[model samples]
Target chain A: MDLANTSLRQLASALHERRISSRELAQAYLGRIERLDGELGAFITVDPEKTLAQADAADARIARGQAGPLTGIPIAHKDIFCTQGWLTTCGSRMLSNFVSPYDAHVIEKFAGAGALILGKTNMDEFAMGSSNETSHFGPVKNPWNLAKVPGGSSGGSAAAVAARLAPAATATDTGGSIRQPAALCGVSGIKPTYGLVSRYGMIAYASSLDQGGVIAPSAEDLGLVLNAMVGFDARDSTSIDRPAEDYTATLGKPLKGLRIGLPREYFSGGVSSDVAQAIDAALEVYDRLGAERVEVSLPHSALSVPVYYVLAPAEASSNLSRYDGVRYGHRAAQYADLNDMYERSRAEGFGPEVKRRILTGTYVLSRGYYDAYYLQAQRVRRLIVNDFREAFEQCDVIMGPSSPTVAFGFGEKTGDPVQMYLSDIFTISVNLAGLPGLSIPAGFGAAGLPVGLQLIGNYFSEGRLLQAAHGYQQATDWHRQVPDMARA
Target chain B: MALTDTDLKRLARLARLRLEESEITGLQGQFAGILGLIDQLQAVDTRGIEPLSHALDLGLRLREDLVTETDQRARFQSVAPQVEEGLYLVPKVIE
Candidate 1:
């Protein structure tokens, strides 16, 4: 079997049986990275020395018969998570030289699990843009079609997994960053309910909407990694205190009697016909599995994009205030005054999209405009959440297309920021409602690019969500298709 | 609502972003487009709806007031753009 093609679970078993050494596995993935990463641009940082050192440590643990299921498995992380002693540039020049002094909670958790840090993948600067084009590191191309964008801000993670550069990679979703990219790149990704995963040291995007998740080739793979990734940390005040669960436990359960809601707003205009057909075909698979499909209405779902733009930026402008010239970020060499230094430094540090969001944020929160824009958006957010609440009452989980369309060519939507923002319309509401949402590869659409079927469950319903996704995945081979880059 | 040049300047200052003269026209257009898209919020009558601050309504988690971290200022300051004697340096405020 191809080492890169193996699943995280299969790799774990192989490592446990001494069929492969961790160092050898790391070297194999490193070789693949060195060969394909130049064209793909998936990773921002890949340290062979650090990766081998971690693998050697895992080998020692395995030698002592103390190996966990994830021991010796290599996983990439989105650059948004702070990794100690590694360049954690969240795809922005502001942090281009900033090596993290500590590990993010997600990074620390993976380390404790004995999983080797393969590398850090590129992302939209500060998780700001839907397409990876906004990255200071340069755009991460789609693995399936190099001319098209790999959906972002988790584009690098999604592309890496799609191309089999890594078995799995850590991602964060605030306004569909994880799910939309996964859809475009044809991978499985899950954004747990807010507070389910500790956000400590994961750079804030939209505070309330941001949640760390995983992108891999299959739901079973996502479940296996999420099992080790979720927990409460006192360090993060928003971390939820919940009993640990084996997310893979319900994977084998049948989908009989499962009620999946089809939101009317999702199928309306904006979704391409090809994507709609793929989603419809996916629902048919569920129907064949004895699952009941119920039509539900989320009338206010159409407003999620508007509400997200307001609230996410409002929080981002505040959260990003810490990146001043005085602190650990970019600073101008010449400045006449303190305020000029702050202004010029930020002006030079942030990208166009980031700067736009910050200005929009500042404008919305400014004295006279606060009530009209920020407060109004917040109230509408409640209405969107209410729509989901009412919809869930009619069904067990909500189903829809992850993205309105498949991956578009580079620079297609970048010209129009509103157009770029609308690409996330389908997945944004899940973040707004703080629900567990998953995107699984259902089938191909335009140009044979993958289409993702989204599964949204009520708060803390990750087990049910994963079970339903796994059920669908087992019945279809869409999740099994790999880009030629990996096969080559 | 259309944003005037004065309004854009005020927003730039509030955001602490220094916009080059060349960036103004483009930014104004982009900001207008975004604001126009966000104007959709105005169509919804949210008079009785309460603004949601969080997705989950969980109460603030309280913890004992204690120093749980070691002093890593030296390590932290190592990455600062300008640091002197373990202090982060900025442009002088006093003459």
Candidate 2:
């Protein structure tokens, strides 16, 4: 079997039928990572011994007729999730030497289902930046073009799945981290409703906005993995205690009479011509599949980027205060006193973008500016949420361009923080409103780079969103297009 | 909305980040641009709308006050920067 081309479902079937042992599957991916990842910079950690040991245990389970759907399946995890003995860097130097002593809820769930840890992928520092350039290890190069970045902070996971380094990867979305990268890498990803997935062990970025999700080759594959990922844990205060869901249950459902909302602000001159054309083409396919297009106005959309910059950083500043050269993470070599230790340790540990955000967050939350900046941003945040609620009244799912353009070259927008923040303009509002959103490869754009068509659904509408995306994937082959470099 | 050097220093101090003298000017420019962008929020009238903190409006869930966790202090402290005698070491605060 061509392991690289096989889907996650097909791999599960082969594993269950004993056609391919989990050990062999893990070794194949390990070999590929060894060969190709040197150029892609997608992974931060890979332990063959740990991987094989888990695979052997999985093989034992399958042999004993106790296998589950995810048993023996190798899945890559974004380094943000703390895996108990592995280095959980969160793409930052602060935690470079810190080994997690306990497993994150996501990791525990996957381990319980008998999944194998393929490796830990790279990401933006503390999940702060739009591009992977903020990563302390290095930027994850887009598999489609070596010079361009895979969008981040889930850049590594999206790039890995796009290159077939792993069938799927666990990722998190604070503001379009999963969808933007997935779109740029020509893969599929989903950020479920705010509290759908437990955030127990995941390192906090912006507690209000951060969410864990999955990046995979197809929307159908995302469903299978998300089934195991979504659950409640008392450890995470925001985790919703909803009944267990079968995320893949609606994958085979038809898209007849589905109302696909097209937010006018998303298409109103912000997106490049090529990306707009690709989204238009995808909409045509949806029309052919018996879905109706409805024009909706998210009038407060333009303010989302500004509001997000204020609120996300405010939350981040508070969340990041724990890294004070105190218990774990990086500590300065020399310090005059405790205050100096905190100041110098943070100065040395964080990258420019992280520092910039911390400062911005601090400025906004300061005494005089609190009412003007932080609180006002929160009030405006409600308007953005209400816009979505009103628009959803007219449609089942919203569709738009995931990013304004395709994968951009490294340093293209790095110098300007505002430009980089705008990269997530299309995906940020959903996070603010706590709605489910999915992005799938629609078609190729300028320079043959992939463009993604985003599908936004109301709260707890992941099943419908996946069904809509699966409908599009069934009619198109964009998600299957791999980069030429990975073919070798 | 532009921040002066003094303002920058104050923010850096509040955030507990030591900024080199040379990096201050560049950071100021970046901050000006970011603040200018977010200043757009000032134009919106959010007079009486309650600020939405949690997206789902979820209240804090109360739990039983019970000791559910065991002692893993050694394992947890293994990754600490400095540890001795089962305690994390930090610089002396009192002179």
Candidate 3:
């Protein structure tokens, strides 16, 4: 059997039945990553010594009957999360040589659950760009089409999972970082309600909107992982104090009487015909499954991209101020004075996209522009949130296309920053509203590329969203489809 | 909303990013594209809407004033480009 294609659940069962040892499974995946990742560029760091060591620990636990569901399950993480002793680059040259001294709350949670860390995946620099081209390491290739970009800032995570380099990977969404890539690469990914997962040691992007999530092959796999990833940590001031939940409990629940809201604005222009057709087809399957589709309105939806560009960059400018050639990260090798060191270090370490965002962010929050840009964007953000609140009153969950188009060729949208920003228009409003959103592979779009159907749930409604996605996956074979590179 | 070279340079200085003189002209065009997109926010009617910083309605969560973390200066500073006596070294500001 091809161990690479096995789901987390199937792997768990195989390990429990003594059919495969954790070390053996780890070896197989490590070998595949070693051979295939050269072309895919899905990982930034993968150490066989460390991977096997973690698997050996899991094997010992399995022998002692102490294995958890995720024990021995190999997974990669976006480099955005700080992992102790690993090069947590955040896909930037700024931290390329900097090894983290600690683990993020998400890393700790997964480790505590006995999940084996295979390696760190690449990402957009500081999670800034819509495409992974901003990564200093080089852009990650879409597993389906090598020339196409795996949608980003979590592109590497999406690519890794989609290519079966690992069963799943942890990703962060500040805008559509998680969901858009998951859609573009044909993987299931979720960005939980803000504060559902702690950002304690995760590198800051846009703090208020940034939420750590998972990218996996199927919604069931995501549910299995989210169970271990959620909960509050006092270390993160923004972490929510919500009770624990069995995120997998609602999976396979009957879809009867389920209210799936179709946002009229989402179906309007901006979404390509191929993507729209795929989403409509997925809705038809849901309708057959006994779910009700109701028309809803998110009037302020069109403003999401502009609002996100303003607010995310503004927060990023403040958060990134910490990287001023002191403490750690990149420092200028030569400088005339203190100010020169600060400026040179940032200019040298950051890529063009990162500098662009920092400049835009600075412009918005500047002395005279604050009210006209930053404050206005914030107020518009409130209107977007209110629109979602009103729409939720009419439906149980919102559904739409996850990205405006399927994965495009590298440099296709790079010339025009506005064109790049528009790619995320479908997925950004969910983040602006602080609602939990999931993207699941629905069907193939243009050029036989995969398309995703997005499900946006009210705050703390992750279980319901997973259940709805899971119900759809059971009736379809899309989630079961793997890219040719991953097939054998 | 049209960003001139002077405006771009000033913004870059405030952002603490040192862009080369040659790179500024190219950046000016890119910045113009982004600004043109975001400028649409100004046309939005937000008179009664309050600006939201956080997505949730909850206020700041406070904790007791107690020591929760132990010092790990050595471990934390291991990755620093330059360090002495646990202090991060940089071009002198005191002088």
Candidate 4:
């Protein structure tokens, strides 16, 4: 079997048929990670012993004829998710030395499905920045172009999947972390409706906005893994109590008379010509597949960025307050007093971007500015949410550019905070409105870098979104194009 | 509305972060840009609109007031930076 090109379904079939053992599959991925991760910086932790042990257990389960769809499948996880014994740093100095004593709900689910932990991939510190540059481990390089960033905070996961180091990796989306990185790295990712996936063990960034998702080679593969990832966990208060879903149930469904919403705001401007062209080409494929395009307006679309900056920071500040020196994170060696310890420990532990957001959050939620900033932003958030509600009424799924441009070089936007924030302009509103959004490789753009076409669906429409993206994937080979480096 | 040094200092204090003198000016400039972007929200008319603290409208789920957790204080505190005798050590607060 060609490991690099094999889909999750194919891998499962191969494993069940005894063509490849689980241990061999895990070893193969670990070997690729060992050879390529040094240049890619995609992984933060990799333990061959732990991986083989899990693989061996999976082999035992398979021998007993108890294999599930994801059993023995090797999967990488974003370091943000707490794995029982793995180092779960959300790519920060704060929790750099902290090992999780328990598994996150998502981690537990994957383990229950008999998936081996490929490794812990790196991420932006506390999921704060657009580029993986904010990660303490170092920025994950784009597989297509070494100097370019794999868009973050899930950059490591996207890079890992893009380079075929792992078939699929768990990721999270807060203002497009998963979709942006997936787009930049030329892979597929989906952020399910908020609360569809439990956030119990995922390290908190912006609690209201953060939702776990996956990055993989195709939308179909995403469905196979998401089936195991999404479910109600009583531990997470916000988790939706719903019946199990077959995320792959709608794959290969015909798109006849499907209404694709073209948000006039997203297509108006700011998008690079190369990206715009790629999206247009993708739309043509959908149009030929018997889908109808409808122009819809998200009148408050421009306000999404401003509103997200306020609410996310405000929530982040509150969520990150848990990182006081009293707990498991980093603490200052010497301090004059308790207050000094708190201040110095936080200062030493957090990176510049994390500190910046915390400060921004603090200022917004502080006295005298609470009603004006935090409350006002929340009110505006309602409007952004309403915009999607009104738009989705006239369409089945919304399509647009995931990022304004293709993957940019490291340090390109890191200097300007607003510029970096705008990198997620096309994606943040989806989170604000609590919708499922998917990004699939449409084609390549400037310098032959990949461009992603985003498909946004109403709440709990992951199945439909996957079906639509799968329809496009069936008609095109963009999702199959691998980088030369990955082939090496 | 650019933030003054006094404003930055107050925010740092509230955030429990210690900022160096050299980093203050750069942070101020960056904050100015970020806040300027955030300031755009002030122009939107949101009269009578209820604030949304969460994406979903679900109420907090209530479970029976029973302890579902096992006593794993040792396992929990194993990763603490400073721990002794089942307690996390911090700088003394008492006078």
Candidate 5:
């Protein structure tokens, strides 16, 4: 069997059964990366030597009869995360050649869980753009169609898993980064409630909206990775303290009597016809399993896009200030004075989309504008949050499309920043409300692109969300289709 | 459709971005368009509703103000394009 096509569960079983050495699995994945990553642009950094060493260690542990669910599993992380020995550029030239001396709490937890470090995937610089095109490195191509675009920010991570370069990869979402790409690339992913996963070492991007989560073959695998990653980390003041529980415990739970809330607003906007049909199909799967659909309303849901643009960039402007030429990023080789040097360095380091966010962020946060723009957006943000709280009172979970449409062509919306930002419209409000959200394959669109259905849950309701997704997956086969895994 | 030189420079300084006149014009147009869209939220009536930064009804964690020492100044500086002593060095700013 091709190890690269294998799921995390199968790989773990192979290691446990001695059918494949953990080192062999690592070597196979490294070989796949070597073969496919060049055209796909799925990775920014791949340390094969270290990965093999990690694999050897895992094999030794297995030999000693001590291995957990994820032990020896090879995975990658979005470039946004800080990896101690590797360069964590977050797909920007500003931090180019910047090596993180310490690991983010997520990375530390993965290492502790005995997961092998495959490499770091590419993303929109600073997680600003919805398409992977914004990365300084270049756009990541959709594995499904190399000519088209992969979804952004976490686009590289989703594409990597879709391309079978890695069985799973870690990703971050600040306004739909994880869910959007997972939708476009036909994979399963979850964005845990804000603060559910530690953000201590990930580079800040719109700090309040940013959340780290996992993308994998199935929700069951996502549960395994999340169990290792989520927990309180003192270094991150936003980290929440909660008792650990197995996320996969209810994968087999019956779906009878489950209340799935369908928000009218999520289905009313610019969603494509194919995407609507897909959402309807996904609903039917739940219905077949004895789940009932309940109508719900989030009056402020349509305002999410407007509110996110203001608040996200406002925080982005503040968080990105540290990258000034003076602190740690690139600086000009020659300058007449300090001001010129700073200006030139920033101009040279940041890309167009990133530069736009910094300016918008600055505008909203400016002295007189703060209250009118930033604070007002914050207040409207509460109405959106409260809307979700009210919806959950009527149903067990809220469902919608992860994005308004499927992946657009590469360079399609790059010229228009407003159009580009709207890609996250369906996904951002969850971050605003700090609610947990999940994206699973609904079905394929007319162009044969993947469409995602989102499930939003109440605070700390990740277990219920996963249970619902798991139940849906049990009733559907779309989640199991392999992507060109046997092509080569 | 594009930002004037004056607005560009002001926006740059506001962001603390320190951009050149050339960079400002390109950035300004993009910001205007983006901001124009975000302006739609202004239509929503949310008077008296508190601004929210998180969904949970939680308060900040207060920790005892104390130094927790774990130094690897050398390690922390590994990503710096240039560094000197225990601090990061930059283009000379003190006139």
Candidate 6:
């Protein structure tokens, strides 16, 4: 069997059935990563020795009859998540040499579940830029088309999964880091209800808007991964406190009676004709399954891009203040005084994109400008949230295109930050409203690139969202379409 | 609403970044174009609506006002460029 392309659930069963040893599986993936990742640029770092050690321990645990659901499954994580003893560069020069003292809560949970640590993947500097072009490490090229972008922030994690460098990976989405890239790469990924996954020790980009998520081959795999990664942690004040439920329990459940919302604004303008056709076709599949489709209007949809830019950057400005050459990162060699050292070190460490956001954030938050810009943006944010609330009253699920268009070539919009930010317009409002959202492969665009269909759910409805996405995956083969370049 | 080199320099300083003159000019052009597009948000009437921050409306749930600190000082300082006597070191400010 081609183990590299299999889902996490299937791999877990194979491990339990003695079809393959965890160490052997780890070696197979690590070897594949070594051979393929340089061309793909999916990983920022891969520690084979450390990876094999964890795999060995997992194999021993199974031998001792103590294996859990995720035990021995290999997964890479976005570099933003701090891992103790491993270099955690959030795709920026600022924390280039910084080694995390403690593991992020997600990383800690995965270790407890006996997951093999494959490596850390690349991303945009501090999870900014929608196309992965702003990364100080260099743009992560799409495996589908090397000249094209792989999508941003969480682009490395999405690319890694798409290229089969890792079976599953932990990714964080501030705006659309998880969902947009998943769509661009033709993979299954979900950004759970805000606070579903604890953010303790994860490098903060936008404090109020960031959430750790998963990217994998199928919605079933995403379900299994999300179930394992979520729960309340005392360390993260924002962590949700609901009792844990099996996220994959309804994977094969029928979609009958499910109310899918089709927002009119999403279908009109912006979205490519090919993407709209695919989404419309998806709605037909839901109809054939005895589900009902309702027309819903999120009148404030267009305002999401602006509201998010103001609020996310405002939080990011405050959060990123910790990186001032005092605690960690590159310090200036020549400094006459302490003040010069702090200023010069920061000026050198952070890249241009990070600087832009910090500047934009600081300006909006400055005394005279706060009420006019930051406060007003916050007010608009609530109106957008209310729009979602009224729509959810009519539909259990919201369906739309993940991005207005498919992956554009690298440098397509790097010069224009607004055009770059518009790439995430469809996915940002979920963070604003604190709702759960998922992205699954819908079909191919006119450019022969993958197109993603997004499923937005009411808050804490991750299970229902996965069930709908899984049902769609079962009937169609979109998720099964691998880029010829990345396949075996 | 066009951003100038002066605006770029001020914003860059507020962000603690030092850009070459060339980069500032490039950024100034890009920022001007972006600002022109984002100003459309001002047309909406959001006068009375409350601004939403967190997804869930729930307020902070305090966890027993207890102090918690880890002894990962050695691990934390391992990445610091300069350190001495259990504290980060920098050039003398009052020497």
lDDT of 4 by residue, A1-488 (tens): 57668899999999998889999999999989989999999999999999999999999999999999999999999999999999999999999998999999999999999999999999999998888999988889999999999999999999999999999999999999999999999999999999989999999999899999999999999999999999999988899999999999999999999999999999999999999999999999998999999999999999999999998988999999998988788998988899889999999999999999999999999899999999999999998998899998999999999999999998998889999999999999999988999999999999999999999999999999999999999999999999987887
Q: Largest DockQ belongs to which candidate?
A: 2
Give TM per candidate: 0.99, 0.99, 0.99, 0.99, 0.97, 0.97
Per-residue CA lDDT of candidate 3, range A39-111, in tens?
9999999988998999999999999999999999988999999999999999999999989999999999999
- C-alpha displacement of A107 in model 4, angstroms? 0.6
Residue A192 Cα positional deviation in candidate 1, in Å, after optimal superposition: 0.3
- Give per-residue CA lDDT, model 2, range B1-95, as digits (tens): 68899989989999999999999999989988999999999999998998988779788889999989999999999999999999999999998
- Taking the true A–B contacts (Cα pairs closer than 8 Å), what share appears in each candidate? 0.92, 0.92, 0.90, 0.88, 0.76, 0.69
lDDT of 2 by residue, A1-488 (tens): 67557888999999999999999999999999999999999999999999999999999999999999999999999999999999999999999998999999999999999999999999999998878999999999999999899999999999999999999999999999999999999999999999988888899989999999999989989999999899999999899998998888998789999999998898889899999999999999999999999999999999999999999999999999999988999999999999999999999999999999888899899999999999999999999999999999999999999999999999999989999999999999999999999999999999999999999999998999999999999999988888887676
Tens digits of per-residue lDDT for model 5 on A331-363? Answer: 877777767777778878888778777887887
RMSD of each: 0.9, 0.8, 1.0, 0.8, 1.7, 1.4
Candidate 5 Cα misplacement greater than 4 A, ranges: B1-3, B18-25, B64-66
Assess each model's interface with DockQ, reporting 2 decimals per model: 0.89, 0.90, 0.85, 0.86, 0.67, 0.67
**lDDT values, one for every candidate:** 0.92, 0.94, 0.92, 0.94, 0.85, 0.86
- Please report, as a residue range, the 10-residue window in candidate 2 chain A with the lowest summed lDDT: A1-10
What is the CAPRI rating of model 4's predicted complex?
Answer: high
Error of 6 at A176 (Å): 0.8
The better-scoring model by DockQ among 2 and 4 is 2
Badly placed stretches (over 4 Å) of model 6 are none
Give the Å shift of residue A165 in candidate 2.
0.2
Candidate 6 per-residue C-alpha lDDT over A1-488 given as tens digits, one digit per residue, 9 for 90 to 100: 58546878788988988789898989999988888887788888899999999999999998898999899999999999999889899998888888887899999999999998999999999999788887778888897888889998889999988888888899988888999999999898999988889999888988888999999989999988887899889789888788999998888999999999989989888988888888888889888988998999999898889888788878988888777787788888787676667667877888878877787787778777687778888888888889999999999999999998888988788777888899998999888888888999988887788899999999889999999999999999989878876666
Superposition error at A230 for model 3 (Å): 0.6
